[model samples]
Target chain A: MLKGETETELEYANMHYFFNDNTIITAGKFLLPFGQFGANLHPSWINKAVSNPGIYGGHGGNGSLGGVTSIMNDTGINVANTWVLGDAGRIFTDFYAVSGPRQEEGDHGGGVEIESKKGDNNDSMAFGGRIAYAFLPEWEIGMSYYSGAYSDDGDLNYSAYNIDFNWVGSYSSVRGEIFGSTAETEGEEEGEEEGHGEEWVKDFDKSGWYIQGTWQARQLGKSWLNPVEFVVRYSDIESDFDGSIEHDFEEDGGKTGSRIYYGVNYWLEPSAVLKLGAESTSIDNEEASHTSVPDDRIFLQLAFGF
Target chain B: MKSIKFVFTIIVLTTSAFSIKAQHVNDPSLVAKGAKVYSENCARCHNARPAEEYSKKEWSVVIPHMRAKAHMTGKEALAVEAFLASTLTADVRHAEEYTKPNAPKKSGAELVAQFGCQGCHQIKGEGGKLGPNLDGVVANKGEAFLLKKLIDPKFNNAASAMPKYPMNKDDVKAIIGFLKE
Candidate 1:
């Protein structure tokens, strides 16, 4: 070991009763020269079946909370050690309706801004894990799998599963994820066909896979007076599904997105840096074929390490 | 038309009054405020000296920390900010000095200065009782965690009696750099 010194660190933060219906708790610990790893847990206080419209894909009633636990290692292995491995796992109850929100959709905590929706909460559970290893200092490859459940407003049931391979490198990282699902709808009542109450409908199971990648680069110390650095990156994902959920949900064969970022890091002193960047991403989903909504973002950051 | 004008005047006056009231109070001159608060409230249980005479970043971390531990109010805390800002070095105003072909090597005093390692504990190879001795600290606590401990002690040990230091980012980095060297 090229011994200078090494140490371990652990940190935790918790916030309860956020937005009147949710609680969040997180914990992290790292071993020196190794990197850091942590876990995040969210528990809901309301019933998912009949909660808010946007709470859990309608069909909301009482629901259980779920969470994601991850372990990441930065491997101080350096050029000599060369190879590193990262592993993580996530487990949840009623995950289809809850976990999907945090991963596939936009953030709910838009600060002071609030959006409202309605529907009964769905019930489901999901669990999965991933393991990846770096063969070269600039590249890594790995795989992951997850499975969960989905429940209708009535006592109907549905299940979902996902598997994927990941490749990571110094300038870019890519992942290919395959997903599938099965569902059974409740039948409508005899007199209320329009309401579709108690009506049981079955859709062919659906499955598909998509691939995404992100790339980055940086430049530093261009001039003594100006002394600035630059960084840029891009990413995308696409998948296909066999069925649709009427006006609420649809199975698009796939979707594609492209993003661009440009930034500068200005060093004011040996210990401080001021960063500014502009970013934009465009996406075309299979279901929303005509609408092109590309997102643009801008930001400024001032950081000091001393 | 006359009634509308009258109401508009009233609204303008009310709005101005509220804005004036909402303005934060600058109760004291900026200099010495952070130190004053530290000596008056925090110094009793914790040592008042800067950790190895930490940089602006170190102070930034330590200062905000006094809030949760000492229960200092928002207004009272602003005064502390002014004091520390004045003492610490300015922003990355001199980037070239760092990236230069031959930057000066760190002197012993400068090393001690940044780490403020002697502030709470002893070095050479022994110093204070307020915290553990550093001779053993460097062995297990690499430069990173040590710097983290200086700025945010509670993160390392929730039960630690050590309070956070409110130094800004640069000062923390400066201290961290020195320790690493």
Candidate 2:
């Protein structure tokens, strides 16, 4: 359980039973393995930068418009396995069924609400899978797909796809992910009165991507400075929707912005890090004439994991 | 009194056996298997770190955490632990040695001799004939050039056959000082 200033939450509660060396079955709420960033870098100590990239943070109001969000967890069951291929490297796969996300009332601090909790809201079950191949010791590529109903009435549906890659070298590392999603909104016809009307469905598209790189100071032959690392990241998100759709979308239509982050991480130890960085965000709102001004900010964080 | 003594002996023997089992592995086949498992499983997400990078105690914590992320079975995790325990001995015995307040500082000439520079290059007319004489190389090439060569000879001379030394900044400075003298 995680305790915060305003709320107490259970981050992950699960049970796993390993059937053998190659297979394991898990039941409970687990962090969704939708992409590399959500699974591998969500932990404060593991992430190199002080703040998450715009795409992965699930902030900036972009994900609400059918874009990919950094889903926290899903109440479900998962089966995962790893297969070794000798010289060709290995492959890891996860197959899961879960209760998918439900849209919240309004935006909270620019963050979208697409994470499902313990209680079930929809009768339909969502199913998806993630497949990753480590072609080499230092390189890996993964692909993920998830689809399900988005509304209690089941008129609205969404499907998301993600492709991610990670490469590590002796002195440098690079990670990147790109995702695209589509949501269909079924609207009632204007002519019909009261609660009865013809249903009209419209599809919206959302997509985002980010690439980050980190260089270790030891590459300069300064082993004493091995704890210091330089990091840089660039990210962008775009959400396109039909203005006629009867949804409370942002005034700017949806979050359409790009961000660049420059930072350095100092490791107090292998498990702890102090991060300092600056972030600049640029919004390309189609209705920029009336949209709020964009601002740049500095980031500072101290994170550790025991 | 006799029963108490027998129970104490049993406890002492069992504790010793458990302690020995936990400390290190002596089986060569298990160690080899562990080495292979460590290399294959740990290298998937990140670079494989050398065992000497962390203390045995540190590994005790790191291994279990990574086991969950990598989805390793209990037996596989144990094998990997055994491999690291058998091979990755700590480089420093004690933390104090790293920050020894009164540790004797070696002189420039002593640093040169420690690195065996005299084996290839001559300083003040005493050394080998494999490389150019360093008697005036410092004056002719400049301190910056000499420093670079010392760190990496091939950077200047592509065909150079000199081996690179893993010297820190202070060691490089001391070697330069000895060459100037």
Candidate 3:
């Protein structure tokens, strides 16, 4: 069972059957294999930081704060396979088709609505796939692409493309990812002709990128405290729309900004961590009237993977 | 409602089946081989977690998931499961033993070697060339100063890459004793 701020839901209820050593088929509501961040690192325990990167929060929506970038669970079928490359390399590929996101009636007033990307109903089908290659024990690279219908009328559509890579050495590790997305919106002409009051279409072009590096102290010396890790990360998200649109991207606290995060993590165990970190956010449109200054935040989080 | 029930039923049965198949192995040679596999493959990405961290059931679920991510073959995965099951279920010290007073006491040189201090600090003409030479430095600095540096290297030097060792009092004293010698 998965519980969120607004809803308590079952995140993934999937059935998988293995065909052989290298192939498997799955059916049910599953996490979409969209990108490395969403598929692997979005979990609170697995993610290095307290908060997710701004871009994984998904794009354009009602004044409400739900988007599809992270935890995009959908009802569908997925086929996955792995192939060994030489002695120390492997290639993995996943293909899936699932019900896409939808805009549901929001609890807030003023005709505001929230986006429901989870598998509520198969209003429209979206198809996508991901391919990843581990060239060495310490290195991996992946590419992801997803496209689906997002509107009840099937007029609005969405598409996303991403590239992510990770490399881990004896003492330090580096990870980076960049993604861009496009979604159709109600044009100004449609809003005017319908006479139904609605917000104008914000820019549909959205892109985000982040790079993180972590250094483990235990590798350098012998101390019970040597398991401490120093981490530094920088992330940025840009939208085609100016600050005119009132809707907030759920993850970024409603503003497009560049963020620098530095933190220290004490590994109680490999799967458990005590983290202290600070994030500095610089809003892109400081002069805009509707834009609010995003304050730098300090956080301490205890995360453990069971 | 019916679909939910069906899904729930399938999950219960599948989990039960997996649990039935999971068992611990007592073979020493196999356990040793599993340990080597874990150190070589699992330690490549992150620190190898202590086996005592999870129960057999927990490892039953966690190992398969990680096996998929780490691209472990069937045989390798099974060996890792056997290793984790045997180790975690057996009497063992937790990974953070240095924090406990009951931790096994080691000589200062053994602690230094265990922590790979020689990789960066030189005792005589040996060890890595990154940090300052430690030869005779302990005599120059008193035991208090040495203890402070051991507990938190960054207390005096913020830029120091030296990690905090969170050692028990006895372990710190032992290391200090070795340095004095």
Of the pair 1 and 2, which is ahead by TM-score? 2
Residues B69-129 of candidate 1: C-alpha lDDT, one tens digit per residue = 2334444355555544443434222334445656555554453443233534545553333
State each model's CA lDDT, in order.
0.34, 0.64, 0.63
* Model 2 residue B123 distance off true place after TM-score fit, in angstroms: 31
Under the 3 Å rule for N, CA and C atoms, how many clashes does model 2 have?
Answer: 0
lDDT of 3 by residue, B1-181 (tens): 2364356447645753553343566554555445445644554344556555566678777776666555565556667776665444232234455346666788998767554455456676665433456888777767888888887665554435343543567778988888778
DockQ of each: 0.02, 0.06, 0.11
Residue A154, candidate 1: alpha-carbon lDDT: 26
Off-target runs (Cα >4 Å) in candidate 1 are A1-125, A135-139, A150-229, A239-244, A250-256, A267-273, A285-298, A301-306, B1-181
Q: Candidate 3 at B176: error in angstroms?
A: 23
Model 1 lDDT at residue B53: 50
What's the candidate order when arranged by decreasing TM-score? 2, 3, 1
Q: What is the TM-score of each candidate against the true structure?
A: 0.31, 0.67, 0.67
What is model 1's DockQ versus the real complex? Answer: 0.02
Where does candidate 2 stray beyond 4 Å? A1-8, A58-67, A106-112, A192-197, A248-253, A286-290, B1-26, B32-65, B71-76, B87-181
